[model samples]
Target: MKKLLCLLLAVATVLAMSVLPAMAEGAEINMFISSPEYADAVNELIAAYKEVAPDVTINYETTQNDYPTLLKTRINAGMTPDIFSTTSGKEIADYAEYSYNFAGSPAAEAMDPAVSAMMVYGDGEIHGFALKGNYFGMLYNKAIFEEVGIEFPRTLDAFEAACEKLSEAGYQPVTTGFAEWWVFKHVMQHFLDAASDDPAALVAAFQKGEAHFKDYPVLYDNFFRFIDLCVKYGDNKPLETDLAGEDAAFGAGKAAMMTGQGAWVEADVLAIDDALQIGFAGYPVTDDPAKSQIIGGSDQALRINKDSANLDAVMDFVNWWYTSDYGKAWFCDVAGVIPPITDAKVADMQIIQQGSELSATDGAAALSICYSSDSFNQAMGEAIQAYIGGTIDKDACCAQIEAKWVELDGAAQ
Candidate 1:
């Protein structure tokens, strides 16, 4: 009887060991994504995840400059990261072939509907997730606006008048981050929204070579007028001012308004002057104040490589990041970002609070920037930069943009 009991115990122990998860032996997941601003927060999240997944390692990497080009190079070399990122909407489809469709996964289920809506690809398969839902608009120094005795403008005419007031009061009216290509997409989307009731459909038509910028006065006339205004009252070197330059000008209290930025810059601006009175509002796209509504939704998407060597481990980490209590709270507490998951607490930052209030009362415009891929956006930026540099006239720039939209995006279709 004693011998039989000992043999039975040994057998049970062996069965338990055999049934243990493969994770017990350890696995490494390589995650290379963009939005380097969230690197610290992500590192913290990775550290916390280590506790739950002690045996699984996550090798994280991020970049802000030429991220797409680098990612494509790695992908072509057959060295795709276990996790990667692309813009949420049309680019989701651009990378669909390489991404996992984890529609029913816990991470996908936890995603906020507004965000998940952009992550959907063919037949409703979820191809990606976001670090945070985003709000795109203008950021202003409230103190300067008050000192200049003018409100943040909501109409093109009002914006010009306000710029005159700000400039007269010895302040740069706007710090345009025109040096970066992505900045053009951020600023152009507001004008795009004002041009059409269904901006997505309009974008598709343009991509299909069925639409022209000349047809939309709001885009060709008012939009260009606004850009001219920005350049007129903007940075001394409008074509040379990048995001950091904008941040420096605004944070130092030299600029009254900052364009081509949104909630993401709040922390950095505040860091420069912790007591800075940051104000958030949409661009003055036209004469209609209502049409200048703020844009909201996640513009960036983080995707899982469908063929990752440690696919299960990657999914496990993502699930834990979305569903776990620590993970949910990290967005607000650590990242100080708008939560991308439902039922999570919002950050107390000024831009976030103002954005939520504006979104509730005035409603936000669709995130029109996502309707097209970054490739077209980059080309458009270059053409516009040439226009700003006086190398190409406005008509020439418009012609180039329309042709490139059809050539790059239309071909993909």
Candidate 2:
């Protein structure tokens, strides 16, 4: 019995020795991102990265709910990932303490200036690089538009006229998921863009408590215009329709158009009916053609953890991701995004082509930057709902947003 036990122990020790070298062949770099929906795309990227660096394993992790809270908690506990995901602006600012300064990287050199401006810290160091961008515009059913004999609207009046036409054709002019608070936040992005092309200045002023939403008549007027559109064109029970259901509704041809939609919605709609042809156009909020623009910016950006144990391996992957064909493929093909890098190749998807054509103009800007991080969207959503339901006037809704912004600004200080 004693001889048998010794032999067994020796066999186990030899098996452990054989496995250790295989494990040592690669360094496992942990990556944390928030969108579980991107699992397939992310997995494809991970596989591509493995092909380039077989010695480095990319450990990708994702969560869909309360990601920011979980990320902050992880950082606070010093359980830092090798690579982390961030948005372009204030989100990167808040995570700057744990992020590496990538000022000298190839990715930094390849970034669009506007994107760089958003990702750079106050100290003049770039903390992150935007990999891909998505645009927000009016996504319309091409077949529906053809049937109604109307072109995509380019001005507020034209938009309203088209809505009337759509309504006359026994269709909902616009499909909106106002029941979900985040939908309003995303939809209002176009209205905000039409009000000010350079919203960073306005956002800064509001942050400093020097500007009010009511003080800017263009913005104030646009707010009411948006509310009117919602009430006039939205589904009978706008508040009851959810985002997922809304996509299905649009794909099913229950509506003629969807305003303030992004590329993902196109994908969602297509998933329901592959042959459904869709078109993209700017959500016109003003009579001035110059103010009518597409809303877009860094949809997803990557940041490196400064204290990563596998910093070298992580950076090697980052360099490959930003410069290699694999990276471009991941952005252009796998993720269905327009790569944020200058001169980056774009996917041949028709929806992407339509969005790119609209984004080429001078009016394209990132409108989400103007949103205050603290409950501002929630407050605005509530106010917009009140206005839509006739519980409050337009002025009251605007005032509520202003007050919420001011209150949040104060709390931040």
Candidate 3:
């Protein structure tokens, strides 16, 4: 009788939780997207979900800035979105109801807890579903490297030597779109992973304000060393150059080495030239490989509406994502995101390989970009751009971020 009662209650709970349109009034659901690259991939996922319930319209909006702040502004304006994304480090409790909590969801049971933890917020409340993960490393053009005779960087010193060597070879080496600001993020994270053997230690430091501008001089020194190379080899004024321009350098064969995380940009690089042989290598490890901590994690995520008219459809979408063969097939073939399911097969993902190989060394990988708050991100970008443009010296560059750190509530890290 007890077992029967439990089964009855389970069915009743699922029924009570999902308010289908037939039972209640429902209409268009808006989703605020934080990433633009995977919109095509997301559209595919959404199309699959639509088959489960075709009445709902997906109202989507894209933004490059902090979506959390946007969420706050929208809420303040009396406009509450039905669904949105809330990253682990940037959670706001007011919007909790609008997110999916993976802890108790069927979606959570089908995958690794760590990946699910990527979307976790509040007191173990999961806010989203993290799909494919990302990693940081160097992207070298095959033709450019071969013509210049520069091999991928294996060690810190070796990378620096390559930077100097590439500069002398009439090749623009280590180009970044500092003008776009986020370009510096991945490289900084990679440098942190190399210098601090503990990936979580970096995350822990960021949360506790223990890391500083000078805590790891290697990043400061090596990054500046790289910036020096960029100034010498750039096709034109690098200060005015943006990520689009930086990408053009690689595509046009004007630059040799570029840093990237496994984001949607992979598609663009692959599309540029059929013959553009691309090789990816982890952030330059320290002299000792074991000490090289892999610093990156869950690439991006999909969240749900807390007040959805149909919880079943949302859960259906998430469950299908990990368990259904059709969902997995689309993700693998179209999106290239390795679903959380353990037995899920993944293709030759360069970023995953970079992080996985490092993990086998008995270390961890935390997404490097997760280290700073939104304000720190902008400040650091400004500093790097100023330094490259010669408007700020090394001391001024360091001081700029230090001052902004104090201004911003990010104590350190």
State each model's CA lDDT, in order.
0.92, 0.75, 0.63
Off by over 4 Å in 1: 1-24
Q: After superposition, how far is residue 103 of candidate 1 from its true place, in Å?
A: 1.3
Q: Which tens-of-lDDT digit does each residue in 1-413 have in candidate 2?
A: 99999999999999999887465567889888876777888898889877878887777899978877888888888888877776666666777888999887887777766567667777889888765666777788999999999998877788889899999998888888777776676767666655565666676666677777777766677657865786679878877777876897798998888754677777788888888888876777777766666776664557889888887887778777778877866787788777777657777776678767767755575756434553666777888878777898877877777777677644463
Ranking by TM-score: 1, 2, 3
Residue 36 of model 2: what lDDT? 79
Where does candidate 2 stray beyond 4 Å?
1-26, 361-363, 410-413
What ordering of candidates by lDDT runs from best to worst? 1, 2, 3
Winner on lDDT between 1 and 3 is: 1
* TM value for model 2: 0.88
Q: Which tens-of-lDDT digit does each residue in 296-326 have in candidate 1?
A: 8899999999999899999999999999999
In candidate 2, position 368 carries an lDDT of: 61
Clashing pairs in 3: 133-299, 211-413, 294-365, 296-366, 296-367, 297-367
Q: Write the per-residue lDDT of candidate 3 for residues 1-413, one digit (tens) a residue.
A: 99999999999988987855453234466667676666888787778767766775666677767776887787677566655665544443334665656577666676655465556676877676665655556677777778777677666677667777778887777766666777676666666666566755665554455666576666667656656655665547766677677667776666787764343455566567556666655666455544445444564556776656656655665677777777666656777764455556665555455445655565554565554555576777888888887887987887776666555634332
- List the RMSD of every prediction in angstroms: 8.8, 4.3, 10.7
